[model samples]
Target: MELTTSNPAQPHGMTWLRDDRYSWFLAGMMWVLIVLMIVPEGFDYQRLATASAPSSGGPISRMLWLLLLALGIMMVSWRAGLAWLLARVLNPFFLLFVALAIVSVAWSIDPALSIRRLIRLGTIVLACVAFVLMSWHARRYQNVVRPILTIVLLGSIIFGLVFPALAIHQQTTPELIGAWHGLANHKNGLGALACISLIFWFHAWLTREVRFLPALTGGAVAVTCLVLSRSSTSLAATLFVMAVLLVLLRSPQGLRPYMPYLVSMLVALLLIYTLAILNLIPGLGTLMAPVTALTGKDTSLTGRTEIWTILSEHISYRPFLGSGYAAYWTAGPVPGADSYAFVWRMGSFYPGSAHNGYLEIVNDLGWIGLLCLIAYIVVHIRQSLQLLEIDRHQGALFLALFFQQAITNLSETHWFSVQSVDFVIMALATTALARSLLEHRLRLVFGQPQPSTIGTSHGMALPLARESFDRTPDGGA
Candidate 1:
């Protein structure tokens, strides 16, 4: 598509509106992508008995997703072109991870399922790349992100209040009774959404990027949803993430140099504490038993430990490779094949996940894939840290998201997902991080100061989308 143009004879408001059409389109695509994946499935007790999550809406929802994604890809191709998007999507470590996932299909107990899932994951990744390109290149990251989150966050409250049967937890388990699932399938999902919403709006408020009243309202609603959801892990993760953000972003100037060391020490302490609470540290767990009980969970962590133990035994059977990418939890076993036995062992409470992200990877792709994942995470984090030197707010936002995902995965499987909100957000953050680092490097090498996407005051300024229309040496748009 060509750059939208408003003739000089047109009114100023008309010009502005014409110039911003791309921005509105970008935001609209993002809303569709995020909202469809995160929207509630209504309350279904039958889903609790099943091991896997339901598909991400019906055929119409998927068809719409694909249509938007195709348009986004075309826009990116025509405007910024494929080179930059490819650079971000085809990073070496990430490529290796994808390659491993593809290779796993060869050894998969269910090759058909593995290949199907790989296609789904690939489509999600492509959408993420297009999303990042449009948002970052156009300097509309916040414009694209905040409104979608606001809608989802606020809609959760409305849904819960007006349609309690669909939004509130039903009689699935004793512990989940009376809890609000909101716009998610489970209370924990709602808690996680609220936790992230709280963190994001709070950051906007702290940086003064957003005005007080609206930011305060967002944060307040987030807190209310979080409390009503009653997801202990999300609650704990939010507090820790907020504390870290405060120390890093709000600390005195003199303490800036020591911040890294302080943060490392704090993280180490938290890890040790978590290990003890989970009884992973031998005698320390016994000592921390009472403390764990106080948190409304025992060492079993609501039966997650038992699930992990069974999963570990199965993972040992494969050791290096794995049963298959997304094939281990089939609905039924092939005759004479033991691969789908986990579904039965998990009984009626089958959680479709290993309850641990790292373990989930191992169960699907084995130790080699686990290593690939670690490398991918490390590479992106290193780039994000480099971005910190160029833009604090952007870096801090990415870090908050990274840590939140990492922490939540300790007790939930939020990684390697194609449909979850967590996956979508992380994809955006990581892609943006890469784009920022690359742009910073290019500016330094060429000695040209690129215009800042994020304002010096941490606000985002929408650059004229007409910049994408700048003529190349060959007179291309």
Candidate 2:
């Protein structure tokens, strides 16, 4: 009997379904899900009381969860072999952190709350996985990101103007009464989204992949939202990322050599800033006084120091493994006595986040968890630089994102939160790093030339693993 050979380009019995239209449709659904996940208010989830609690299995939330699960199932079915996909995508440090979160349930203050939040976190990770699988192709990946952000940014502006009550937060402090939330639950959320959109669009413009007018329009929209939201941290982080990007783009060949010095300078600046905030250095407060006046804040950073003081005291109670994920901030209509007092000190009735990502991680998982997170970030940074060597445009984008997250984390707590836009962006960067590394490893192992997808040009494509598999005679070993 003669053996029949299958077409290497189409594997896993998906050849019949391998139409560009199908891929685009799947990607479109994934993009919509991302927008919904990041900005739930865009879909009016904020209007539903059921979307309030982390542990509340409300109908709307349950339905959304089912929808996400269905999407993941569809992606896995289309791709075939979830196990193999996961093996390639999973980063050890990230996986370890997730594992730690799961084990934290054993020691959680509220076991039920911890389990529920863990499930939500898992859902977010799985959704991210599905996204990576669907948009594995470079052009497809850019298509997924660019159009989604453009629509979201433009839609935010339209929604804010048309439905001010829903899109803007009216209950903010007097200083922020007219601030535009723009399809988000809070003004800062809009600001953060705008900041990242600015970075993405700016990269697209600088690379000249898109036409000048459209790129300029996208950037303008992002800047307008960012300014209207009045989020100082987001604004500052955006500017900082832009500066770093400019430097890297100008001297791509010198990036790796200067990375060590750049990292040292950043650490030094952080230390000086911390010292100045704590008044540990003489005359530092005086030096910062002018800067503070311009930013409309005091040396105390508008009571953030007080909140940090309170959190630091509580952190000592569980130094190694703090109150389980999202456990400490759950008391009642009001927070527990200590947290309530902290909020009262901040002149707010509700207990909010630590407002510092590092502190929040320490509060949730302790120093050990924080170290794991640091390692994960370092690995990603190194990997991002490696990608830059092959594809400067994509590398610069990844690095800019990394810096933006790092800087924002100094003042906001979105490191590993469920369904947070910041976390989702971080997940995306991590997925890209994984893809880059996988491509490099496969090239080394098989002694094959790098695919055309790896580039150092304006339109650099992603070196998709599927392409490598398809090129093989027997669909890869």
Candidate 3:
């Protein structure tokens, strides 16, 4: 009898797993998942109403997401091994915050609702973790993400033009009458998508990732949608992030050391402006008046400050641990229900959030939760800044996304919302940056070959697996 030795890591008939096919399939699944999230139920109004009920996601969608998570976990186990995957996903702060959310159910005003929302949030975070582990290269990450954003942007435009009744705001508030919601349930949703696409396509153009004409075309589409949606917050956040990205990406290498200081100054200015917009800083309003006017908003920031004032009172009730994870807004979805007391006070409107991420965190998880979230963001920011020294393009992209999220969160809450597209991307970006930084440090310590170089851009090329298993070549990272 011939003695055949087998590797435990690679069981018999597992040769099929040595290719990039799984990566591509996972990327496609991610695209589908994002699409399902941003554009739900074929943009059918009635279906959207039922789907948008308090539960973060419908049953079918949750199951599909979980299925994708399972496939991703299995792929990581087979390709990179669970330990390698864990190294990327075991972010301490993220885990702590999640654990806090889970434990908060004990004190939640509505434990059942908290439990349901917590389940959805858990799925989202895990899905993001899997996306990070499976995405072995920055270029692959961009490839999977860019097209999804572009298609959604373009689809929104087409939807607005072809189905005006469904896509355009109808018998709503006087100011919002003609605003375009497109395939999204709200105009701000469409605007947020457009803003992100604009930033991405612009970055693609800057880095020559896509042809100039195609990038320009994508940006133009995004701009059209942004203008039609009339989402001032998205517009402002998009501009701020784009400016930061341009300075970081286009500046000469000689100025890299000073980039941090420059960015700090910019962030300071942003902080002051955010405070002014929230009416927290009475003095800076005059300084920001011109800029705010350009965005077509009044001193009240379209009544957001008022909402903050009202929500602040509620937050004061449970200032420490919070009302419980997603428990504050437990009222029925009716127009004039008792649960909408805050909403009615704000504007007799339903914004579905505190209009601020920091406030949302405080309201949901309390000051402790806010501290954990800030720590989480700080850790990712440090990683991205360190990444700038190793890979400019990827680092700038990550940093830009972080800044955009920060800016948007000033006027919109996406920090922990299960249905938020921005939160999803932010999670993916955080994990990718963490993985890349960890890999770079490990290589330095182990004296392994530096990460594979691609082009002259100093980009980190992460192979899909260990050299022994990455038999199928990838196009590029």
| lDDT, candidates in the order shown | 0.65, 0.66, 0.70
Q: After superposition, how far is residue 52 of candidate 2 from its true place, in Å?
A: 6.9
Estimated TM-score per prediction?
0.80, 0.80, 0.83
Model 3, residue 43: distance off in Å is: 4.0
Off by over 4 Å in 1: 1-21, 40-57, 72-82, 85-92, 135-139, 266-295, 331-347, 445-477
lDDT of 2 by residue, 1-477 (tens): 000113243233212111122466656665756675566543663552233434254586577777886876666555444225344545668878889999998877777777877877776666666666533544345556767776777888898788877777766467468888776666777888889889988888777768889888888999999998988878887887888777777766645678646754764565455457655477787767654665556766666787777788888899899888876776343555445666566556453688777778888898888888888777766667667766777777888887788767766778887646778667766765666555444443234332233222121111333444445542121
lDDT against true structure, model 3: 0.70
lDDT of 1 by residue, 1-477 (tens): 111123343222112111223456666776777776676343343463243455444577668766865875675564464234346433467667777888889899779878877876666666666665442442356556776777776888888788777677776677689998777777888888888888888778777888999998888988998999999888877987887788768989898777556645655554565565445568776665654654566655676877877787888899799888887765444334454455567653445677777778888888887887777766765565555556777767777777788778777777776546787777766666666665454323223322333222211112332222221121110
Q: Which lDDT value does model 2 have at 33? A: 60
User: Candidate 3 on 143-171: residue-level lDDT in tens?
Assistant: 77878888887888888788777788775
What is the Cα-based lDDT of residue 48 in candidate 1?
A: 39
Q: Number of backbone collisions per candidate, in order?
A: 0, 0, 0
Residue 469 CA error for candidate 2 (Å)?
Answer: 11
Clashing pairs in 3: none
Ranking by TM-score: 3, 1, 2
Candidate number with the higher TM-score (1 or 2):
1
